[model samples]
Structures are given as structure tokens and as C-alpha cells.
Target: MSYIDGFVIAVPNANREQFIRHARTFDPIFVEFGAIRVVECWGDNVPDGKLTDFRRAVQAKENESVVFSWVEWPDKATRDAGMDKVMKDPRMNAAGDLPFDGKRMIFGGFAPVVSLPD
Candidate 1:
């Protein structure tokens, strides 16, 4: 099975364009680093949930709109290796003025339970 890294982060409405710009800059690097897929989506339909919900698992913030994303890899080892390279890549570093709060970002690795075709 493939390895997946999931991320949910608060994004201010005003900075939506900035966030998309950063994603566009990072997407190709992620692919070049061997990520099989990179998916990014705005928080359009998150359900209301408590703090405990987010602490226990991936969930949107109550007062903040979010960007939910995932990156897929062949396996854990490959994911780790690719991430190391991605982190060191200069293009990734150039995204320094990221529009969102890095501290408020929630992320993790997940083994997919199911993935349906669109």
C-alpha cells in the first residue's frame, strides 16, 4: 500500500491567493521528489467539531477556514526519503512568506482506509 501524508491548516480568507501560489510553487517539487500524488483543497464543507476532535484526528478548526491536503508515495521509506529532499530543495525554502500560521497547521501520515475514484 502507498504511504500518505495528510495536512489540515487554518488559512485566512484574505490570504487564499497567496496560499494557492505557494501550493503551485511546491506541487511540482513534490512530484519531482517522487510523490505520486499531491492534492490540495479548500475547506468548503467541514463539520463543526470540538478541540478534542482535532487533537485526536484530522479535523478542521472551528473558527478558521482550512486547506486540507495530502501527498502520496510508494511506501514509508520512499516517502521519508522524498520528504528529506523536498525539505532541502531551494524551491521549498523560497516559500518563506507562507500566508498561513505554521504553528496552527495540523499534519500526519496515514495509511488509507479507502480511496474512491471520482
Candidate 2:
């Protein structure tokens, strides 16, 4: 089974283009470092939920929109190695004043509990 890192972050609506530009700059680095896949999805269809539902999650703020994304690797070891490389890459050295609150970003590593083929 592959290893995966998942992320859910609040991106300021106004910075959407800048956010994507940053992500695009990193895509090649990730691929060269052994990432099998890099998938990024904007939160166009996120359904209302405790964490995402504005009325329920007190933390949900007005200026931010959700960004759900993930990266896939052959396994945990490869993922870790690739991430280390990614971190050391010169292009990633400075974030260049990102638009959102980094502290508020949520992320995790997940072993796929279930997946169905198309």
C-alpha cells in the first residue's frame, strides 16, 4: 500500500491564485523526489460538517476557504525521504509571505482505510 499525506488548510479567497502558483512551483520537486502523485483540490464541493460547517465549527472564519490536498508515495520510508528532500530544496527555502495563517493549517498522514477502483 502507498503512503499518503493529507492536508486541509484555510486559504484566503483573495490569494487563491498565489496559492496555486506556489503549489505549481513545488510540483516538479515532489515528482523528482519520488512522489507517485500530487493531487490538489479546491473546496468547491465540501459539504457542511462540524469542522467545515460555519455554524458548527467556531474556528471557521469568514475570510478563508478550504483547500483539500494530498500526496502519494510508494511507502512511508519513501515518503519521508522525499519530504526531506523537499524540505532541503532551495526553491522551498522561503515561503515568500504566504496568504494564510500557517498556524491554522491542518494536516496529517493517513493509511488508506478503504479505496475503490474506478
Candidate 3:
């Protein structure tokens, strides 16, 4: 089974293009390191919930939009190894170059439990 890394972040509406550019700049590095696929999604229909929601989860502000993204890996071991390289990669270490607030980013690793077309 494949391993998944899910991410959600709040990016300022004005930084949409910057965000895409940043993703384009760095996402491929994940593939080079062993990710099978990387997907970045800009939220268009996200809604607020009474108590909690994607927006609230990341403390999204009125001027920001939510982004949903993920990386697919062959397995946990590959993901772990790939991620270590990703973090150590110099490109990812550029100072003050992130398009969004890193503090507001939410992420986690998941193990898929089922699939529709197995």
C-alpha cells in the first residue's frame, strides 16, 4: 500500500500565484526523492463550519485561502527516507522565501485503509 502525506495551509489570496510558483519550484524535488505523485489544490469551495473546518484548522484569515495538498509514496519507508532528503535539500532551506505562513500549515502522514479499484 502507498503512504500519503497530507497538508493544509492558509495562503494569502494575493499570494496565489506565488504559492503556485513555490510549489512548482519545490514539489518536483519530492518526486526526485521518491514520491510517486504530488498534488496541490487551491480551495475554491471550502466553507466554514459551526465549530471547526479547514479554515479554522489553519486559522485562515479573511484575506487568505486554504490549500489542500498531498504526496504519494510507495510506502512509509520510502516516504520517510524521501522526506529526510527533502528537508535537508538546500532549496528547501532558503531563508524567508515561503509564500505562506509556515506556522499555520497543517500536515500529517496517513496509511491508506482502503481503495475503490484494488
Candidate 4:
């Protein structure tokens, strides 16, 4: 089964361009480590919820916007191996240029139950 690594983050609204540049630079490294595809989405219409929401999930501030992203891998084993390599790569340490608070980023691994026909 396909595996997915998903992420949700809060980015400073003023740093959209910088965030895109960072994503562009780093996304390929994930692919090199065995991710089949990566998708990053900038939130356009996310709304506030009384119970909980993307903003609350990440504790997004007034000046920040939400970003949802994911990386797909052929399978969990492939993802695990690739991620180990990815973690060992020195470039992962370069968080200085990140436009958002890395600590607040939410992420997880998932096994997909359904995917629409393409």
C-alpha cells in the first residue's frame, strides 16, 4: 500500500515568498530519498472552528497562515528507509531560513484507505 507523510504548519503571512522558496529547495531532497510525490497547499479559505481547527491545531498566530503538505512514498518500508537517509543528510539541519516555526509543524505517517481514480 502507498504511504504518506503529512504536514500542517503555520507560516508568517509576510513570508509567503520565502516559504515557497524554501519548499522548492527542500521538496526535491525528499524525492531523492524515495518520496513518489510531494504536494504543498497554501490555505485559502480555512475557517475558525469552535472545537478545534487547523489554526488551533498548530496554534497559528494572527500574522500566520496555514500550510498543508504531504509526501507520498511507494510503501512504509520505502518511506522508512528513505526517511532514515533523509534524517542523516546534513541539509536537514539548515532550518535557519525557514519562514515558519518548525516546532509548531504537525506531521504524521499514514496508510491510505481510499484514493480517487485518476
> What tens-digit string does per-residue lDDT give for candidate 4 at 32-93?
99999999999999999999999999999999999999999999999999999988888888
Candidate 1 residue-wise lDDT, 1-118, digit = tens: 7889999888777888888888888888988988999999987766556655432344334445767899999888889999999999887877777788787788899887776761
The residue pairs that clash in candidate 2, if any, are none
lDDT string, candidate 3, 17-89, tens digits: 9999899988999999999999999999999999899999999999999999999999999999999999999
Compute the lDDT of residue 19 as modeled in candidate 4: 93
What are the TM-scores, per candidate, against the unseen true structure?
0.82, 0.84, 0.96, 0.94
**Order of models, best lDDT first:** 3, 4, 1, 2
lDDT of 2 by residue, 89-117 (tens): 98877768875667766778877767676
Scored by TM-score, the top model is 3
Sorting all predicted structures by TM-score, with the top scorer first, yields 3, 4, 2, 1
Q: Give the range where candidate 1 is weakest over 10 consecutive residues by summed lDDT.
A: 54-63
Better of 3 and 4 by lDDT: 3
Backbone clashes under 3 angstroms, per model: 0, 0, 0, 0
Error of 2 at 42 (Å): 1.0
Q: Which ten residues in a row have the lowest lDDT in candidate 3?
A: 90-99
On a 0 to 100 scale, what is the lDDT of residue 97 in model 3? 69
